[model samples]
Target: MEIIKINDFNNHTLSESDIIKRILSGEKELYEILLRRNNQKLYRVIRSYISNTAEIEDIMQNTYLKSYEKLYQFKHHSSYSTWLIRIGINEALARLKTKSKVLHLNTAQNLNSNSILERPDTSQLNPESKIIRKEAKQLLEKTIDSLDTKYKTVYILKEVEEMSIKDIANCLNISTANTKVRLHRAKHMLKEKLFEITTNVDIFEFGFSKCDDLTEKIMSIILKN
Candidate 1:
């Protein structure tokens, strides 16, 4: 199939309806536009669950393939990006199940609780300052990575991805109430993890300074492939 040049499709002007119509009318190349548009977001989504770089790429590819195969079944009730997120979540979950990776919900909850106590105070600094904010953001990401998959996915979706709880519920195929509960628990776990990391150990000494950077490296490697 010919790949569409997604970089050329300006985000504000790209019409999902038009893309769907094109794909349904035997323009398979149009699907690449959707893939490219959603790839970074989906990569972040999948990475929250699967830490292994190779496995994340594999799942991402599988998600797009599955989405293409099921395109005819899409009813257009939700946005195409939302539908794609659902497919990505399902693909990740299926792979996790096959690999027998335990989610360890309780562990995540515990870690979040620790984060709150460990978080550094930047209240006196200019929140608008880019350099300070960058350091603060990196600290926040480190705490996030310490969370278990269950909490990590919800937290990343709700916080990092800025998705609504309703959207997250649809992506996870869980009720909104459950999503809220998991998010609450995940937050507590992240707080706990951060608290432990900050109070008990030197982050530099532990070599965790590179945890946030690892995701970018992983993404670079995937794109290179």
Candidate 2:
């Protein structure tokens, strides 16, 4: 089988509407546009909840298949990218549930309010302090992995994806207020997780730069495609 490089997808010249029209009219190649456009975002989102590389790949492929199958039902009320992300989240959660059972993991009780309140303070720190911060970040990642599916999804969408609360609400089919609350709680949970590792450290400094780099790489790849 010939592998498709997302960088080679030609969505730059065509508007999303035009691509959707083509896809609806049986232009299979146009589907590549959607795949390329959202693959990295989907991958990042899935990776937050899925540690197993094989399962992550399987869920991502399944998400695309589901998106393609449900294309006709898309009303275009929001961008197709948004719709695709919703599908990806659903697929990721479903896969996580199955994997949780197999691994005998209980993710529901991970985000406790008392735990967050007891976390350390890391709002200000020097660059030289990154070594300790890096270890703390690993602890944070593990804690985030322990959160319930709902909270994890909200955190990944809001923090990692940098999506607005309104956008997250639409994507998750939930209320804006709920999305805000979930995000707040998720941040608190992350702080608690990091606190256990280091008393005083900067958490955001570690991941945001890496995420920015990844975003730039994805954009460069898309433009090249």
Candidate 3:
């Protein structure tokens, strides 16, 4: 089998559709490109639902394997990343149920909103800004974790991930209008003026080292089968 670097295509990365075709035709190793491309996405999506880092990693691994097994079943009705998110959410929800964390759109409401703070950003920052960003990130992470899974999931996908409202709706199997409503609710719940500032600071990041580690692990298991 010829190994093709996705970026070798005249400096243009291959589309996920093109890569998926190759993988379906026996170039299985190319799936690594897909994994590396979307690891950050899958991580944040699952992280929004569950807080245990180990369990988050576990569900992510399972989500990748599950998606691979069902890859042929994917009809491209939606973007592959969107499909994977739905699968990851299902896997996360199953774990939540197993852990008895009642899965409901309106659940986890007893907590007060006054204590909540705001969001993230991804650009390089100076030392002073970095310190302030880190502190803000910790506070925002804490605040986000306090919201109900339903609210935080949309919030992260929207504010942090910057996924389109339609994409978020598709991922969550809800209406686009409902997606907007949830985001509004999440922001209101946080009640912080720093929403845009924090996104530039990298909230819910799955860094490069972790991304590579996950890629290798998922590749090893899939290639073996």
Candidate 4:
């Protein structure tokens, strides 16, 4: 097997479809390209459902394997990223159904939620901005955790993933009206929980180290199998 560097191609130029085509055409190494590109988004989607680090890693690994196996069935009805996200979300939900215990979110500790606040310099405003951002992220995660699973899933898909209402409905196997209602309720709950906060900051980021590690592991498995 020949190793290919996806970065050799203009990273800004090749779309997901282009890479998928190449992978299907026998450039299997490019699958690592796809994994590296979408790792963070998929991790965030899965992280929204469960909090166990080991479980999250397992689900992500399975997600890649399942997606590759079903690649032939994927029609171009949705963007490739959306299709991948649906696969990841569904896999996480399936694992949740099989387990009886509820998992906790990473909470403030693992999030390093106080790092920004710990360092305060009057001359530097960036630290203040970072602190605000960190606090907002913590608040957002707390608010999301407070929501019921249905609302939380819908909220994350719509708000965090920026997925369309119809797409979310389809992905979750629910009606559009139901999706809308759930979204509305979710927003209301978030508003009630986050009345004091005003800025948007993304939470549940997959760290760079973990992203690279997972990508390497997935690539190794793909090559081995």
Candidate 5:
């Protein structure tokens, strides 16, 4: 096989710090790998806070671009994924803050209600199985969505993203004990036994097509710089 291009993804061994150094030193294309690597986790983290698809994509784009702009300042104190997740969380929360203010000003009527969960395309499954799986997924998503913002975020990070408690604490800038408390509270609020059944379900999926489109949009902008 030909040697990998400067922009191509190759070895799995290089740490994100190594890639960031190279990107800073002038191999900017490598940034695409970082974007792709963290896209799903970042998307899920943001999705747990915000349900609007358009706004989620906007925040994802801004997070990728903002991270690239501030890449030089990354201190390596945490994994790049953690750092990026923190940025995505901040952006989503900020958007919500601004939105809350707008709603407060307008005292608007009820806003549009659109579902963020993707309905499973169960073409191969029998009708009965399809109905069962779909309802279960909806109920699970709604249950998780019912959580307060603080608890929902920690819950998604711990249960859905499969992150450790310490990592979740670091990302949220909370103490380990606080992280554990929030997670415990979240599980309790979700009710017992629900977590067990929903363990493997992919709730707010960032589909491959959606990911590629977002990645390319950001990549195109990066390459232009």
Candidate 6:
């Protein structure tokens, strides 16, 4: 269960490909670095499909496991992050299909109560502004939770992950134009959904502590196999 400390690596600026090469060259611990780096992005993608925190963590583990198993198949045609995220999105969608869910949005318990949302650096702002922003973010989170699964998935991938339309289309197995269409529709839907709430907000709330725990859990599973 021992974790690799950050200071263990002398070269802190290794690229993703460099790290992947090292891991493939028998430096298994280096894999954890990638996990820690991308866990939040993967978690947010998975969370868009899954409402339950525990289930999201489980799928995150599966995503990492699958990616590791198929690492050899990853051609360096795209960035490592994009390749990793394509696997994550596919895994999340597969899990979504397994649940007995209707085409409509499925409601679940609130994940926001735990407050994993990363607060923007507000050092200069007064406490009152921070409180207002927090409330606004919570409202936006709730509204996103209410979006239909398709729209929600597209929205999270486009907005939260900041993935290109072409990448999103490739990841989702849809045409690029179709991907743009969905993204446009999702934006309009979100506007209508949040019209009453007059606060600009960010999406996706993965805490560092929770992300670290999940990364460790995923690594433990990977090491076992």
- Clashing pairs in model 4, backbone N/Cα/C closer than 3 A: none
Q: For each candidate, what is the lDDT?
A: 0.74, 0.72, 0.78, 0.72, 0.79, 0.74
lDDT of 4 by residue, 111-216 (tens): 4222211223445557546555555566667667677778987887787767789888877778999999999999998887676444425422533344556789
lDDT of 6 by residue, 119-213 (tens): 45848767556666776777778788778767777788788777888877777778989988888888898898787554434332543344556
lDDT of 1: 0.74
Regarding lDDT, does 5 or 6 come out ahead? 5
Comparing 1 with 2 on TM-score, the higher-scoring candidate is 1
Model 4 per-residue lDDT at 156: 75
Highest-lDDT candidate: 5
- Candidate 2's C-alpha lDDT? 0.72
Residue 98 lDDT (model 2)? 81
What RMSD does model 4 have?
14.6
Deviating ranges (above 4 Å) for candidate 6? 1-12, 101-106, 114-119, 196-225
Task: Show model 3 residue runs off by greater than 4 Å.
Answer: 6-12, 101-127, 192-225
Error of 2 at 138 (Å): 3.8
lDDT for model 6, on a 0 to 1 scale?
0.74
Model 5, residue 62: distance off in Å is 0.9
Candidate 5, position 143, lDDT:
72
**Between which residue pairs do clashes occur in model 6?**
none
Q: Runs in model 4 with CA error above 4 Å?
A: 1-12, 101-124, 196-225
lDDT of 3 by residue, 93-114 (tens): 8987877765454444343322
Candidate 3 collision pairs: 119-198, 120-198, 120-199, 120-200, 121-198, 121-199, 121-200, 121-201, 121-202, 122-200
> Residues 97-147, candidate 5, lDDT per residue (tens digit)?
998888763332222244334544847987556666666666777777777
